[model samples]
Target: MLSLYRAGYSPWHRLAAGPKALLLIVIVLGVSLLPVSWPGPAVAAAIAVGCYAVPGIGLRELRRQLVAVRWAIGVTAAGQLVFLGPGPAAANTTRVGAALVISALLALTTPVGALLDALERGLKPLDHLGVDRQRVALLLIVTITMLPVLARLAHDVREAQRARGAPPGLRHFAMPFLVVALKHADALGDALTARGVR
Candidate 1:
C-alpha cells in the first residue's frame, strides 16, 4: 500500500503536478457536492472508472487499491444501510469508494518530491502572511512518509509479540511499540540536531 507509485510513460505520469493537483481537487469537489442520489453516485463511479482508464492506472494497481479499501467500503455500506436504506446507502458508499480510488490514483501517479514542489509553488501566495511554503511542504512530506513507516513498525511489533507467545490484544504490544517509537523519535531528533535543524 505504501509503494503506490508505478513508473510508466503514461500521460498522467508526464503531467505537471500543479495541474494534476488542481484537477484532482476539482474532481473531489464535484463528487462531494453531488446530490446524494442514485444517478449522482452512479456518475461519480463512472468518473472514477474514467480515471482508471487514464494511462498508468492498470488493472493490478486498481485491484490493489480496491482490496486495500474493502474493509472501509464494507463498514461504510453497513452504516449507510442502517441510516439511509438501500438506495441512498449504495449512492453514498459508491461516492466514498470513488473518492478512495481517486486519492489512491493521485498518490500512485505523483512523486513525493513533485508533490512537495507543487505544494510549495501553489502556496507561495501565502508567504506574505508569514506562511513558510517550503516548511509546509516539508511537513507534508514528512507526514506522508511517516504514516507507512509507523504502520509497518506496529505490524512488526505485533508479529514479534505473537512470536513470543504474547496475547492477541493491543495491550500486550503497546508498551514495546511505544518504546521503539520513542527510540525512533530520539534518533530522528538527534539527527536533526546534528544537522542544525530546528
Candidate 2:
C-alpha cells in the first residue's frame, strides 16, 4: 500500500500521534479564528511553512505539499480578493494554506498505523452507543491517510495531461482524476475487506 510515513528518528516523529494531531488541529483552528484584517494568520502561515524544518522533513517535502494545495490556495485567495478585498484575502488564504500544510506535516511525522491506533483508542468508548467503532476509526483514519495519496494522484494526472498535450480544464482534469480515484477506492475496499476491516 502507498503510505506517507517518513521514517524518522527525530523527536517530532517520536511524539504520540494523538496529542500531535490534536495540537495541530488546535493551532489551525486558533489561527483560523483570528479577527478579520489581522496579520496573525499570515505569520502563522509562514511559521507553518517553515515547520518543514522538522528534522526528517525537508525542503522537498515542503515543496511537494505547497504544490499539492496550490490550486486550492489560489482559488481561495482569488475569491476572497474579489469579494472581501486584500486583507481578508491574505488572512483567509494563509489560514487555509497553513491548515493544509499542518495536516501534511502531521502525516510526515507520524505513521498511518499509529493514527489508526489512536483513533481506535479514542473511539472505543463509543462502542456502547452501538456504533461500529472499528469501522468508524478505520474510515476516519483512512480518509486522513489518503491526503498524500490524493495529492500524488493529482500530480500524476496533471503530468499525464501535459505529456498528452491535453489543454488543462476542470472537466478534463476531473474526469481522469475521478476515474483514477475510484479505481484506488475499489482496490482499497478490496484490501480492507480481505483484512476484515468491513
Candidate 3:
C-alpha cells in the first residue's frame, strides 16, 4: 500500500533526491503563497495537472493521486465554503490539489530509499544537537507515505457504510474511522519501538 516509486528511465527519475525534494517543497510553497484569488491557484493547479505530461509520469499516476486525495479535497472545499465563503474555498481547494499532485509526483518519480537518504543528508546539521538523523528521516518519509493510506482508509470506510445501508454522514463515520486510525497509530508506534526508536 505504501509503494509510491515507479521504475522509470526519465530525467526526473535520474535527478538526485536532494534537488528533487527541494523542488517539490519550493513549487508547493510557491503555489500556496500566491495571491488568494481564483486564477492564481487555479492556474497553478492546471499547470500541476499538466505536469503529468512529463516523460515518466502518466495519466494513470495523475488519476491515482486524484483518487488518493479526493476526499481530502472535498472536505477542505466544504469546510472552507461553510466558514469562509466561496472565494477562499476555491483558492484553497485548488492550492491543496496542486500541492498534493506535486508531492505525489515526487513520490512517483523518486524511490523511498533515495528520499530517506536525502532527508538524512539534509538533516545532518542537527546531528550536533543530538538529533538522530536516520530516525528523523525515516519518520518524515513514513509521514509522507501515510497520507495516502489515511485517505484510502476513509474511502474504504465510506464504501463499507454504503454497502451496509448505513446513513451517509460524519456522525456515523467518525467513530469507526477514529478507532481504526488509533489502531493504525498504535501499530506504527509498536513498529517504531521494535526498531529501537525511543
Candidate 4:
C-alpha cells in the first residue's frame, strides 16, 4: 500500500526523496516551535491537503492513509485534552496532528528507493569518520521495509492463534514473532550478501 502510494506521477513524486524527507523534518520542527496559533497548524494542514491536489494523486487514496492514522491522531488529541488543560494545550495537540498528517503526505508521495538513495548521499560525509555509510544505509532500508512487514505478520499471527484456540497473550505471541522475525532477518542478510551489498 505504501509503495503504491509512493509510485504516483505527481510533482511531489518527481521531487528528490532526500530533500522531501529533510523538508518534512523541518516542517515538523518549525511547526512545533511556533507559538500555539491556529494559523500555523491550519496552514500546515492546507499545505498537506494541497499536496494531494497534485496531478495523479488520488484523493481517495490519501483519505485512506489519513484513516489509517486516525487512531494515532485520536490518541494524541485525547491525551492532550485529558492530561493538559484546554485552550493552548488543545492547540498543541492539533499542531502535532497536522504535522503527522503532513509527514504522511510527504512519505506517500515520495519513493522509498529515491529517499534511501538521498539518505545515503546525505550521509556520505560520515564515511570519513569511519561510520561505514553503506552498512548504515542498508540497515536503515531494512528497518524501514521491515516495519510494515512486521505489522502484517503480527496481525496474521494473532488471527491464526485466535483461530487455533490459543489465548491471546504476549507469552504466546512474543517467542513465535521473534523466531519468525529472526528467520526473515537471516534471509534478508543472505540476499544482501549474495548481491555483494556488504
Candidate 5:
C-alpha cells in the first residue's frame, strides 16, 4: 500500500528532496492563487504532462493517481456548478486535477524517508516556537504512509462484502474499516513507544 516511490537513477530521483518539495509548494500555491478562469490550469496541465514524461512513470501510474481523486474532483465540480457556473467549475476542477497529478509525481519520484528528513530539517528553524520538529515529521510520515493503506483497506472491505453477497455499500464497510484502522493505530503507537520515539 505504501509503494508510491519508484527507485531509479533518473534526474528527478537524483535531485535533493528539500528543493523539490519547496518548489512544489511554491508552484501549488502560485497556481491556486490565480483567478479560476485564468491560464493557471493550462500551465499546470503542461507541467503535469512533463511530470508524466519522467522516466519510470507511465500511463498506468498516472491513471491510478487520477482515479484516486475522482470523487473529490466530481464533488468539487458539482458544487461549483451549482454555485458558480460551468466555466468556473471546469477551470477549478482542472486546476485541482493538475495539482493532484503534480503531487503524485512528487511522491512517485521521492523516497518517503528523504521527504520526512527534509521536512524535519525544514522545521528545525521553528524550534524556538515550541515546535517539536522530529515529532511533527514523524506525524507527517505516519499520515502519508497510512493514506494508501487506508484506501486499500476500504477497497478490500468493499470487495469482501460483495463476495459475501452483500450489497456494495459504504455503510457495510465503514464500521469494520474503522475498527481495523483503530487497531492499526494502536499497534503503531505501541511500536513507536517500544522504539523510544517519544
Candidate 6:
C-alpha cells in the first residue's frame, strides 16, 4: 500500500501531504461519529473505491493490495460480527470495514516520506509545549516503517514453522514469534544507539 501510494501520479498524489493527512483524519472521524446506518458507510466505501480507481492505480493492483490484508480484514469483520450483537451489528461491521478500506486507500496513495514530512510539520506546534516534536516525529516514522518489516518477519517465521510440520495455531506460534521479535527489537535498538539516534 505504501509503495502504491508513492508509485503513481494522480491528483491525490499531487495534493500537499499535510492536507492529505488532515483530510484522512477528518474523514475517519466523521465516519466514526456518524449514526449506525447504511448510507454513510456505503458512501465512505464508495469514496475509498473511487480513490483507488483513479488513474495509475489499476484495479488489478488494488486487488493485490487488498489480498495482502485479507486476513486482517477478515479478522476485523469477524470480530465486529461476534461482538456488536444483533440490531446495528451489520451496520457497525460495514462501517468498520469501510474505515479500514479508507485507511488502506490513504496508505496506498500516500508515500511514507510524505507522511513523515507532514507529521513533522504538523506536530511542530507541540514544540512550544516542550513536546520534543522531532523525536516524536522520528518515532512515528520508525513505527510506520516497522509494520512492513514485522509483517515480513512474521511471514518468514510462519513459512519456517510450516516447513517443520508445525500446525497453524497461536499456541504453537506465539512464543517463538515473540522471542524472535524481542531479539529483533534489541538488535534494532543497538543499531539505533550505535548511530547516535537516542
Top candidate by TM-score: 2
Over the stretch 16-130, how does candidate 2's per-residue lDDT look in tens digits? 9999888888877876776656567767766676677766777687787888889889999999999999987888888888878877767778887888788888888998999
Instruction: Give the TM-score (vs. native) of candidate 3.
Output: 0.78
C-alpha TM-scores of all predictions: 0.73, 0.86, 0.78, 0.68, 0.81, 0.71
Worst 10 residues of 4 by lDDT: 1-10
Which runs of model 4 end up more than 4 angstroms from their true locations?
1-5, 143-198
Cα lDDT of candidate 3 equals 0.83
Cα lDDT of candidate 2 equals 0.81
What pairs collide in candidate 4?
A: none
Q: Highest lDDT among the candidates is held by which one?
A: 3
Q: Model 6 over residues 57-146: C-alpha lDDT tens digits? A: 666755654655567667766777788765466666556655655555556667766776888899989989989776687687667556
Candidate numbers, best TM-score first, in rank order: 2, 5, 3, 1, 6, 4
Model 1 has an lDDT value of 0.76
Predicted candidate 4 versus true structure: per-residue lDDT over 104-193, tens digit per residue: 665567566666687789889998898977778767766655544565566668778889999988999998888877787788778888
Instruction: Give the poorly placed runs of model 5, Cα more than 4 Å off.
Output: 1-3, 144-149, 159-166
- Per-model CA lDDT versus the true structure: 0.76, 0.81, 0.83, 0.69, 0.75, 0.68
Off by over 4 Å in 6: 1-6, 58-84, 143-156, 159-166, 183-191
Candidate 2 residue 98 Cα shift, in angstroms, is 0.7
Error of 4 at 141 (Å): 3.4
lDDT of 3 by residue, 31-62 (tens): 87877775798777777877776777776778
Worst 10 residues of 3 by lDDT: 1-10
- Candidate 1 at 14: error in angstroms? 0.8
